[model samples]
Target: MNKTTLRRRTFLQGIASTALTAASYARVRGANDRLVMALVGSGRRGREVMSAFLKTERIELRAICDVYDVQRGRAKEAFKLAPTEIVALEETLQRKDIDAVLIATPDHLHLAHTLATLKAGKHVYLEKPSSHKFEEGSKLIAAVKQSGKVCQTGTQQRSGAHYRRAKEEYFDKGKLGQVIFARAVWHDFPWQRRKIAPQPKPAGLDWERFLGDAPKVAYDWIRYDSWRYFPDYGGGLLADILTHWADVAQWMMNETRPLNAVATGGIYHLNDGRVNYDTVNAILQYQNWNLTFESSVLPIRNERPGVLFQGTEGTLEITRADYVFTPYKGEPTVVKAEGNLEVAHATSFLDAIKNGTKPSADIETGIAACNPVHLAKAAYWHKKRMRFDETATKMLSD
Candidate 1:
């Protein structure tokens, strides 16, 4: 067999073995009734996801994993978990009792942790902006497909009430006919970036483990606390909020990848020693339409953050909770969102696990959402337009 085929076969065999092992453990522990879950990386986003999972009584949070003792202790106290439950990921994934894991680690660690979780025979709920680099997404997608697991991405908008309605009632219905252009904007005032001096590493902190697969760097409080500002840990605002809007655009348009991308912006306000830009304006060109995305932490306009779809007959404005339809000649109509998206998203994962189905934001969907953000970053860094391959699987240089 060819090398690629041989590798794939071996990977599938490993997954089968893991599944059989987990199945035996599940039968012994009555896991068919309720799924046992573990939370990896108990930071801000980790706690937020924990809250959402708690809203549903279907799954039990059995363990917490983190490199730092502080986050592990915090999660343990908040969740009434045992000290034994607060352990390393290597230990948590070894627990066959865990039917699934919620991976809220940094972007750089996502690919490794996700691969390990899938290999360990557990379902994964990974946060968005799935990888630190663009190339890592393909590996993640391949692993998820081979493992035959229910892996969900944390693009919660796909499960939101208004967002669903907008796609079904407006976009899919063609009420906004012949959509040619779209604009998405996120303008807000973030807290000022401050210089944090380096301090001694905390006890029980596995610094090297936190830097897995990332370039070696001395531990700094600023980099650790504000990881989004550095490329090693995060992809800045592009990977932060831009990925959400890009996903929404792709979902609304029923498209995955764009044909070309260009971006322009800089760290206009935050003079702090951050590597990412604070202001960004990017455009993604598709075969049938174009999507323009802009994000600025400096603009203090009266308008809140939203996305606008301009079609031939009308325009639809959408936010996290609501959507407004403004026809060319008729009065505008608005729909307020109903239900909690976080709960819905979490519930969907559990349902998918039980039904052996795919969640709304699966691995492919996550990669589709994250692809444009990576392209935008490339365009910004290179100061040139970038072209996406015909298959939309790889980004090509200009």
Candidate 2:
């Protein structure tokens, strides 16, 4: 067998051998049963997700986990949580009372955190770009399957009512005929490029824990505060912002895997000691169609954050607020988004657990959506066209 296949088999074998016992699995909850949930990471995104979970009925916040005391304090203050509720991830996972975990950790910690949560026999609501590296996607899928838990990925658009309606009306019914080209864009605002001043590491902040498996280095406030722009912790704008729109494009097109990808970008504007690029443009080649994604933190004219699908018959554009379709010869039709996306997504996760149904953005769906972004990054880094081997779940050498 090839090296990639061998590696995949070995990883799967390891997961199977270490699978949790039957008794360790989380018990099924009834329709009205209260779900005892914990929040991991407890950062800005974590707090936002926690707020959404609070809006859902019958969800009890049992614990909160974070490495930084300041972040923990912020979560406690925003949620009215008790000081005792703050716990380390290791201790929190050991609690039998906790039924599920909402993990909004950094990209690098996603695979490790989600795998540990699944191994602990708890359901997970993992944030987007599920894996830091492409190979970790299969590991996550295998662990979730072994644990048989409802693991939802935080691509909230998948659970949105308007998104579903637009899919059903336009792409699903052939209203947009034979879509050939698609574009996803997410340009950053000026505030996103704010300068970070170097400061001493805060007291009681576990910098090592925050670093996770990343290489050890002197504490830099920029990397700690804006980890998304760093290559070690995150995939920059592509993984942070483009993944959501790419997932939507893949979902609407019913094409999950991309055959190959070509990407180009650089840190032209925001020279803030970040390794990741500030401007990026990538094109993913599928079986029959192509999808492109572009983003830059620098100022650009008429910049909008959304996805556009162009077909033979018409064109459609969708964003967080709304979706509009304009036929070749008819007036454009617009549909405004309704309800809270995060709240709806949280509710869907709860419903999936209680009903034994797959969440809108399950583990497999999450990985599939992320794979293309990973491929694009590979192409960008290598400066060559990169192809993906779906069976072995690895990027092929040029």
Candidate 3:
């Protein structure tokens, strides 16, 4: 680590003890008054998270912040908030009256948004993967300590009943024998296929504002909306989707950090013109066992949909729905499964905000999930079977 990070880390170590006490002591806002929130980035996922936040009875969304004015207007109409339009993210964060901010910005901007929000003393509901860089996540973790903000990650599966049940019933201490391996997969048509091209920036859209922290580039609608396929903006499927699997893997394994990470996958499927592959896979090895997460852009369904936890006593399958408990009692015992977790995920964040507690998917948990994600993606990109760097270990897809 660098001196600045080391110094900040040391300072954060001291603040962690007393910061929550300060948050607890702060004067409570009015019961009738809704917490003022700002939504940064009006992308598809951003809108989804906003919809969840807007569902709450006590939240009065004050402003919608986005670089693209079209998205801002669309979001404003969706949430019915007369958004205080912001192109520059820092300006949006500077509003002292805002109680919290939701960052649905791209991978590269996550760290900036998290740091800025914490510095502004507003709690954050940051989207998945925490950040693009592993070390940057450490910075955000440190910042959270210094700020004492109730930061929540976008890994909403933790709030789902089925996932929670799966963790408790199967992965809990000696519950369903020992969890030997977990396989998570997300497969679907490549996100780049049907996205529209970026039209000319409308009069209200602040192109520069939307490009915050990202490299300067010309406008392309496909690039803006389908940036997940491009290295410059998104982490493709790994950061875009697989982080949810990573979060569950950590939850199931009861682990915060993976001792090693190796990923290997190739672009064998989709012929979309994007640099990112259509298929990607990675394995995160913890102290006791290993978990594998993969995605294929050509087909959305997995060999076994959702996440599969193979244990000694039984095989527990946890997907987007209800989990399946198939006991290996000499003969197979079949249990059907189904799940709808959208509402459950939404409820947890608002509850945490009101109760002054951490949400189910907190920042530390989000960062750890992304560590393997970033490591594995790097490995896949470099085409190495096994590559260990200071940040995270990587293995090529077989």
Of the two candidates 2 and 3, the one with more favorable lDDT, higher being better, is: 2
Give the clash count for each candidate: 0, 0, 13
For model 2, the run of ten residues with the poorest summed lDDT: 23-32
Q: Which candidate is the best by TM-score?
A: 2
Q: Which stretches of candidate 1 lie over 4 Å from their true place?
A: 1-32, 80-87, 189-195
Per-candidate Cα lDDT values, in order, are: 0.85, 0.88, 0.74
For candidate 2, what's the RMSD? Answer: 15.6
Model 1 backbone overlap count: 0
For candidate 2, write residues 1-398 as lDDT tens digits. 99999999999987876665332443334322788898998998999998999877568887878888888889989998773455468898999989999999899999888988999999999999898899898899999999999999999999999899999999999898889999888885565588988899888688888898899998888888988778899998789877898899999999888889999999897888889998999999887889998988877864457899999999999988899999998999999999999999999999999899989999999998889889999999999999976574679856
Candidate 3 lDDT (Cα, 0 to 1)? 0.74
Tell me the deviation in Å of residue 277 in model 2: 0.9
Please state every model's RMSD to the true fold in angstroms.
13.5, 15.6, 14.3
Question: Candidate 2 lDDT (Cα, whole model)?
Answer: 0.88
Candidate closer to the true structure by lDDT (higher is better), 1 or 2: 2
Q: Write the per-residue lDDT of candidate 3 for residues 97-116, one digit (tens) a residue.
A: 79988898887788887888
> Candidate 1 deviates by what RMSD?
13.5
Model 3 CA lDDT for position 116: 82
